[model samples]
Target: MTQAASSAADRRALLRLARQRLRARVRRPNAGDAITLALPAVLVAGALWSGSAASVPELATRGDAAALGMLLAAAVAFLSYGMLFRAADDPFLRRLGVESRAVYAERAARLLAAGLALVVVLAAYAARAGRIPDQLLPIALVAVLTAWGSGAAATTLAGRAMVTRSPGSGWGCLTVGMWDREVAAAAPLVYAPLIPLLSGGAAGAAAFGTGWPGVGVSLAVALVLARLGARWWEAAIPRFGPQLLEMAFAPPPPAGVGELSVGRGLARLLPRAAAAVWARDGVVTARRFAWATRIVWPVAIVTLALLARRGTDPGTRGWVALAALSVWMLQMVALVGLGRYERGGRRWLDRSLGITPLQRVLGRWAFGWGASLWLGVPLALAWGWWTDAGPGWPWVFVGAGTAAVGAIASVTAAGWR
Candidate 1:
């Protein structure tokens, strides 16, 4: 075939693959599945709306638009993580029987299109909120540009991480989370919408007053990082396919730990049976620690650092700090609860071993909480010191205690389900 014809054929194949994937994703879920996916969002939104009357005063007094912008950026970063890093698995690439920079260039083009769509939506919202045409246009343009840059930077960070760490490693999940959090904390304004909301001004003022040059610098950095990531990705692609296949085909590694006399040693501190159960659960918790620990603390620390450096209104600062602490605690609990469900299949075995449901639940809770404490102690100390809260020991105790109770409650609820 001629070069032009060959290229046309390849484009057709890619378009067809894209269509298939879209159809697969759009297939309707069952009623129950749809409800399961959506009920939490509904409930949370409903609760917020219901409480808005009561919350208005507090919210007005302590709201931080900048902080909210950072959170939105973090959410987008998470949403795009898979898109940015794992194009090797693209069905179109397999069909093409080719691996080249052109594939990624195509992917980047698609992302740009999507980013433009997002910019358009955001511009409409700004206009509706009374932004003049001049402000709206510049804001839209900046939002798209900044998003492109942020996404490229995220991709580069993931690629660099892939080069340094195996995804299957124990800390791999944590490392990825920390990177996301750090990026969000560091470049919160990249999302652009946050600027006007916080500034309560036209786009030009927000853009310049909040240091718009940073956005251009980020774009420059992203260009350099993209080059580096592409080089690393090219080297890594050859090994990627086999590694995935091996993982898919491999059997589960056996329950890899021996029964412990350690449980007996701790029996004096707890019920003998509970201690034994806790020890076994401890092994599992150690092996499959939650990704949340990696995420929450790093994000919280970075946020605190930002607050200290930027110096928000004291009321806003305190509220933000408390909110961060709450998030960290809630995340720890949710992770523990999820882990219990993950091991639900083993409940029968515990029953067979004469362990009551309550004991099994508590044991898992204990292990989760204990592991969280080990992680939280250092964080609490850091937070306390950062806050200049005298007698930081109270913060340490509060952190550990809150984590323990929350985790226990989560595990118990999961068991009941």
Candidate 2:
């Protein structure tokens, strides 16, 4: 019991240290740094606001208004966190637990694991309990993107706070109510979004007892519940709090240490081994970590669903343009592939040739395009399904072909370099 108590005390001491470090990093910013961080957000908001101003559509009813309002709120919270995090550059949050080098490689891996779990849980919940929106496919898309955005907010805030922060002083956004510091950082825009979301939610809950008055009231209540629920989702910073979700599980065995020997048959695949090696890592480095890729098709699918539901006349040219751009963005992962390989390149290189700059460049393209095709094929199929263009496999084949074209174009251009 004495030993256990001592351990607990040590843990608390360590956490406090990390928290102090994070706070310090957030403090003491220079004027230039402050302005540089602030500018991009201002430009984004101005552009979006300007767009909204140009066409003030009547909020079809209370529900439309609620979602639109929440979107703005989500946007503000996201943007402010981004600005603050960028300025923070705090890495002090890491406490003196695990060795630093192992922690770095595992961070990405651990995040991916958590995200996969989160996605599976949320989908199961939605499938079982929630009344997904009528524009469900698109709604799913938006939800996916929103989840990614939520992550962006968390990382930016925690990462920037890194300078003064200990290695692991992560953010628990549910604790945001206490963070008047961050919430107040971008007041002009922040307030605009948050007020409507919060107050409207409070108002909606009061009306939930309205008892099936109409579809309108049902959705309004749902919005209110969502807003309240979101407020409670404070993530536990792994290193500081309970330490449940470390970026990695057990540290991977080091080079020349515990590698599994491949049998003779598996050795034949060696030529293609480099491609196989980086597949998952490459997709991950490409922002699939945020589940941003999942958002694209769901949005496209939802949009297509809505269009079909309304029986709207579709323009072929518009769709072709949309398809081309969608494929392009999906393929952007190729450019970022090198980053993942480089992160853990030492271990990979032991069994292979060392990565020359050119090989690194080529490998990145290969991984990016390979994963893009993985995503793009389905998106194209869904488009065909929705539009009734042809049978499913043909569209899938077409998408695969188009994505190949994009891969070649991307890798060939100086852009991938």
Candidate 3:
């Protein structure tokens, strides 16, 4: 075979292998798991859709369409970045004599396919609504392409950052230490369009224009970024491939001083049995990078609230604050299962330790509530204060209520397990 043909075959083979691995990992969901996961997601999506439908008339304008497109792009980019890192098997592929470029190509193809599927779904929805302008359709398509390319490049850079021990400062160091280098690297990409969308100026309008010229420029930029990402992947693989593999397979490190201190503080605040469970859950969550990264959802909600205050009404701003707190609560509740179910032999070990079902349930609930309160209070207050709302005292009560709901829901779900 010619070199080009040989390369094509390699990519095809990699794609097939990736699909097989995905299928192998994804077990058929039980009814309880289906309801637990699907119900909340469906409700949230329905609420968001209703709100969006109410504003469909406003989407006729170029600025509104641009803003919406940017927001969609940001969402796709962030999800793609997270998914890439979470499921990366680059080192393993490298060991199989598959080139890094091939791996990157396969991943990029999958991301683009997913982004295009989203575009199709949104396009169909907009068509049914009959409010979206014809000109904005291309803009939406370009936005997805841009997002996919940006996400791929960001993920590559983030992977590179993870294996590097270079000293960093500020939030970069802090987030990287938490195994959130993907978030740190992708933050700028995620926020670039958001800033303009929130600020709503002439420049912002021009940058996110829904014209064909803008779409063409965006497509070109996306292609360039994808090219750069491929080059970066090829370069980094030779240098950092082994380190990435090692990090992927390495055992979780022991809990740090911060975790221990948090546990000690919770111990003093709670009953002995519950505190032990709370402390154990905290440590377990901290040690698992994937679980730790779920904190991003709440943080993203808060960030949206902060940005949304510029043109939003007081009532809307209040709701945004409430949503931020509520999401934090829900995020914690979702994590309860991750702590108990993901690790092998964990349930057996818990039973061996003489931890009763009641204690386990109470501890999980307390941990979820406490963690929600710890993160949500400050975020809600900040959102309220920044939005010129009162000290956000009302949101604290709202958060507490939601946290209780989440805690109860978590315990009930655990019971089903």
Candidate 4:
């Protein structure tokens, strides 16, 4: 790029930043934003404080730290969620006649500090009044972590916006405006999957019969996952919107049968799957929601693996894999819904314009199967390796077959009323 072009791009970015800040300051505040931003934190906090009061006493008498540990764990989760919940900077900040960045920065810091001080005072008094609760450690840790996440949400947004304005060749715009909504929407669901694991994780694992030892091993594995995941989330959060957008707008491969090479660095993407994976479905399957669904499988498989480690024999683990069909079935349904949006709702609208459903289900299964494995193959291999279950054996056959069947159900549902 020439010096003129580089200077123009920089100028555009700075102007855009300034314009956004101005708009945020001038925009009117509304009740909905306030409700949306604060409600989850309130509910989580209420659950942590009230639920712990009752459970902690019972567990305290028995010296069972698990109950308290669980409560604290929950408290921390709510706290973390609250922290990560990105509240839109009030557009009305400019109305207060203190709109410049320097002033805004100073004010934001002071407000955050004051809020923390007030919370600390209130919490200390509440604990004292409640007779000095026995298990506040977890609750406190979780709450602090949550606040940190919340505090960083804006910084994350700013960093993301900066990246957007300077997207190098082929990189697209990732404006704070567009992603601010998407991340805000998706953030709530992050805890949705985990909540099931927290409360029902044991029951799900017990389906394998490894007992607490199984659960322990599952957690040990999850911690490592959590660390890796945290690192990935930090990198992905900023550019995810633009990257996701590009994935959507980029033209898909032709329906050709030959001369395709995925060459991204995965054994599963070997010619066998790649050749069969049609470009259209391949791109659809390769997108965000599809990958998210694929990731969900590990969460499920890990729970089952814990059971296997505890006492779920290899055969029983296979059985658990079969039962996993239910989750796959449901997730494929989600994919179908996402697929509609991904395709810009053209197909659905066409159907509405009087296109009839063809009876034969020929490509439906293949589409779902290809897509499921498109996401699942790597996951299955990872599962096999992690559980020491002899790689390439079950993952290659049983896992693939099960995923295929589930995709069939999901695609089939697309045709139904």
Across 47-118, the per-residue lDDT of candidate 3 in tens digits comes to: 446544444435556576557666657556656654554445655666677656776687778877776766
TM-score ranking from best candidate downward: 3, 1, 2, 4
Q: Compose the digit string of candidate 1's lDDT tens values, residues 1-417.
A: 765566556656555676676565448643332333344456545544444322321111113322323333333343343454445465546555655344444455455555555445444444444443333333334434444545554554444444455454444233343345433432322333233233222222333323446446545654564455456555554554344344234233457543345455434576666777677655544334434455456555665565466433556446645755665565554545454544446555666778765665566555555655543555455445555444345545565566565555544434433
For candidate 2, what is the TM-score? 0.36
Q: How many clashes (backbone N, Cα, C below 3 Å) per candidate? A: 0, 27, 0, 6
Give per-residue CA lDDT, model 2, range 1-417, as digits (tens).
Answer: 464464455445544654575466458543222333344346544544444322432333556544543443343333433332221112433445432222221332232333333334333434444333333222222332333333333443343243334554534443444334433333332333344344433332333323234334434443443333222222213332223223213444346643333223333343444344345334344332333344355555554455355322456525543654564554453333223323343434523555343444444444444455554555555555555544445544454454444344433332222
Model 4: per-residue Cα lDDT at residue 210? 32
Least accurate 10 contiguous residues by lDDT in model 2: 81-90
Scored by TM-score, the top model is: 3
TM-score of each: 0.48, 0.36, 0.68, 0.33
Highest-scoring model, lDDT = 3
Residue pairs whose backbone atoms clash in candidate 1: none
| CA lDDT scores, all candidates in order | 0.47, 0.39, 0.59, 0.40
Distance from true location, Cα of 93 in model 1, Å: 8.8
Once fitted onto the true fold, the runs of candidate 3 whose alpha carbons sit more than 4 angstroms away are 1-6, 18-27, 30-52, 60-62, 127-130, 157-217, 245-256, 259-272, 287-337, 354-361, 378-417
**Better candidate number, 2 or 3, judged by TM-score:** 3
In candidate 4, the residue pairs with backbone N, CA or C atoms under 3 Å apart (3 or more residues apart, or in different chains) clash, namely 24-91, 76-142, 79-146, 83-149, 83-150, 210-310
